[model samples]
Target chain A: MTADVAVLGAGMHPWGKWGRSFVEYGTAAAREALADAGVDWCDIGSIVGADTVRGGYPGYVAGATFAKALGWQGARVASVYAACASGAQAISTARAQILSGLADVVLVVGADAAPKGFFRPAGGDRPDDPDWLRFRVLGATNPAYFGLYARRRMAVHGDTLEDFAQVKVKNAAAGALNPLARYRKRVTAEEVAASAVVADPLRLLDICATSDGGAALVLSSVDFARRHGAPDPVRIRAVSTVTPRFPNTVLDLPDIATDSAASVAPPAEPFRASIARAAYEEAGIGPEDLSLAEVYDLSTALELQWYEDLGLCGEGEAAKLLGEGATAPGGRIPVNPSGGLASFGEAVPAQAIAQVCEVTWQLRGVAGERQVAGARVGMTANQGLFGHGSSVIAVR
Target chain B: MSRKRTPVVAGWFTGDGTDGEGEADFRLLGTRCSACASVFFPREDVFCRNPGCPGGELTEVPLSRRGRIWSYTDSRYRPPAPYVSDPELEWQPCTLIAVELEAERMVVLGQGAPGVALADLAVGMEVEAVPGVLNEDTETTWTTWHWRLTGTPGSAEAEADAKGAAGVVA
Candidate 1:
């Protein structure tokens, strides 16, 4: 098993379309995390920032930017960008630093001030970039791909539109309890049906929106945590950052086509499933051991897909599991207890870090009304563009 | 006066071909790996993505004209920039289909023919490739390919439908 790193503190700026710079949100979250950890900025040996593309110049050097915003103290800095999985990458980098004995105390932060409407590629005529080609050639926006998955689920698994709407209803109810969630009011199936269709078979409410948000974590070595007066703290056991095996069959985001399976047989497990499997293997635990899960619910349908991918249920059994209330509050394996993207919308870089924060809070028994009773183990699963895997397994 | 016809992307579609008695031949162009026989759409000219096989030369090949619809959807709102469309014109929702080619064993995505609404398509319906104009101005006409419901290529009904579907770019 990999060495563990104590999660000394976790914090976030409330998720919403708050018009502000990413640096400001990140700094706010970082300060809160520092205060929670009772660790001064000057004592931190390292700072890692999840890069945001929309932040322009400062975003590219996010670690230094956050350092500057927090008052530069000459701490070692690292910046990472893996599309939506930026936060997890940031955490992975910090964990590596701690495990290698390079740093005793590390602060990881991710924040984004997202643009309104569909996320588009940077303006250019470059045909080589897959992101640009998908838009310029097919005009296949992100929702279009989500609609394809939703429709495919309806055909393959006998899922219905009602099943998809129930996901929104359940997550919305959970979000109503989360103070940091942007949409706090519970949503209903009728409201989801009444919403305008952004893409065929997917209404505006069925898909997550773009938002401005931030999340941060203060991590330290186990020895450092004990010395700092917290002998027992929420610890990250595994951070799975794997890539898709060759001949990937699933049509992932921003890709116009899947890799051809003519030359080599595709792997039996899809890319997303392998992501969770890697984490499970590294953490030496299975899905049944998980007290709760926080998955990237980019769309309500996608959440059901993640249920199966995470092995919470068998293939084509996600809807049945949801029907049994297994993924709802007070159920066997509650998901999105902190209100997933369904409630928070998406802040890209900030999202994965926020998932870990939710897991950290739940593992510590301090998640308030949304806390899972007797929670000991929690996991977060997310995938980013260009085949970046982001899943974390945490335990107290 | 004749308007100049240009491809939205060069070498992606066959140049206008006319046989005796004026029949047009159209096909989407792709590449096939010489070593592994793997097919690529939007044509991978440089290297074969198949990791098991050693590097091989990629040669141009014509893709199958017909395939089954694996899944489909439509953009209900105007997609942001890079996709060219006139803002003044009424926004017409365009259907997009992921077609699974049996021989190539790969799914290729494309815009559906105009007048083909969500009501007209099923998950496994068969669609055929056909040449269509994406957009046109006084100076040039951008030509691209569209997927239409499988029917007799030159029948009068198909011709009328193709005319209606032309220029309805995504």
Candidate 2:
């Protein structure tokens, strides 16, 4: 609401499985972003990294690790881990540093070199850790959690598998236009339906793959940006990192069951919905004012779920809105213009940062083929595991 | 000789009596919140997850001897997990059951008891939580739970082991 930080530059390593280290990807993205911002790496006052658990040690030391890889300038560094929302958290960390005047310029980086199959827990028989326990006990792969969500939708919303596949179709069609997207080929509903079922009601095509990718952003204070001969830069208005209210009733991933609604009535809005509401409130904007949104679409059905969660449409009507192509590239408010997890797969920490990078690019009108037309305002909404709020709003 | 039959998981159930050619007595292992009188399946020991109440001691608590089948589904594909499987072997569907434990007021998931048919199980059907073999290595056996549908017509297949399969929490 007050003097927010400006997004001076953004960069990314194309999303794919390269089987390399996370540091390599983050360094490359960091170099690209620094070059784009025309700011020397040494000039960056602080660095923040979004961590990836799947990527071993470097991913954990992400911020300082990437700084060391880039020939450490001794910038104050911080690393954050919030599952898929890691990148947004990294950006929020950098924003806080910038807005606090502790740093005139900040570098935010998030990258991941993911595993081949279902992301499992670190080698251990630890029954105490919920992440490990879920895998050990239920064998609920991430897709199974996605499956549970999809099934619940079918039971409650009368949503069909066809509706889910169409989301893949729409996103893939848009992905075809994104050069940075891993899978640029257009997909059909028939094709999606034919793909092997990874989980009940969700086919292989319906699920996003694990990928190795990187994204970085160069953020600066508004005063610094203006002084650097960059006037009217894209401004980051809000970063919502709110947690869920009490009486949590929804069954989230890695959990065996939902909290009992019998104890207290569940809240009207879910955690994801609250994520966007907070961002909108902070930005002094609403969904009607948005030109585009980037939501975590881990599965095709999940994208439609985000539609309701982000208040793009009322609950259970996401399927209808999607069927009408309201979320496509040319739609009224395009969702996932950066191809989403559908095309990019999941690069973990990098994905949320990548969303902000897309919004920055779109607002700057530099986004080549996948640009949202006349985009003035954009919001990237995502939720991290174990109740972490990760969403960012950028406006021109 | 064929591989020596053993419990798939170790330390889950006691009383070594086979239900058929390859089975053991069933028990669902969990921990009880000594503070709130609540129970958690898959066991919780670090701290009582109940936020409203003051911190309490947690001890290993056995779950309900029997439960009702709240919902059921089948994994047509092999689940990748602590679940061990052979890629060389042909895949067979394993029935996944969600059972509602009355005392815990929580649902636990497990494979259906051996010989329990997918068609025979239904919502609200009386079921019992029992120990089942998940897999085994030469050194260790991974034990887990299963829900055997009870009182279904022509359920003699599950009758012999029904009572013992669903173990009472000690």
Number of the top candidate by DockQ? 1
lDDT per residue as tens, model 1, A215-234: 99999999999999999999
Instruction: Let me know the TM-score candidate 2 reaches against the reference structure.
Output: 0.86
**Isolated chain A TM-score, each model:** 0.99, 0.98
Tell how far residue A252 is off in model 1, in angstroms.
1.3
Q: Please list the residue runs of candidate 2 whose C-alpha ends up more than 4 Å from where it truly belongs after superposition.
A: A1-3, A245-247, A261-265, B1-39, B56-81, B95-107, B114-128, B139-141, B148-170
- Restricted to chain B, the TM-score per model reads 0.83, 0.73
DockQ of each: 0.61, 0.24
Position B121, candidate 2: lDDT: 63
**Model 2, A339-394: lDDT tens per residue?**
88999999889999999988999999988888788999999988877888888999
User: Which sections of candidate 1 miss by over 4 Å?
Assistant: B15-24, B152-170
Identify the candidate with maximal TM-score.
Answer: 1
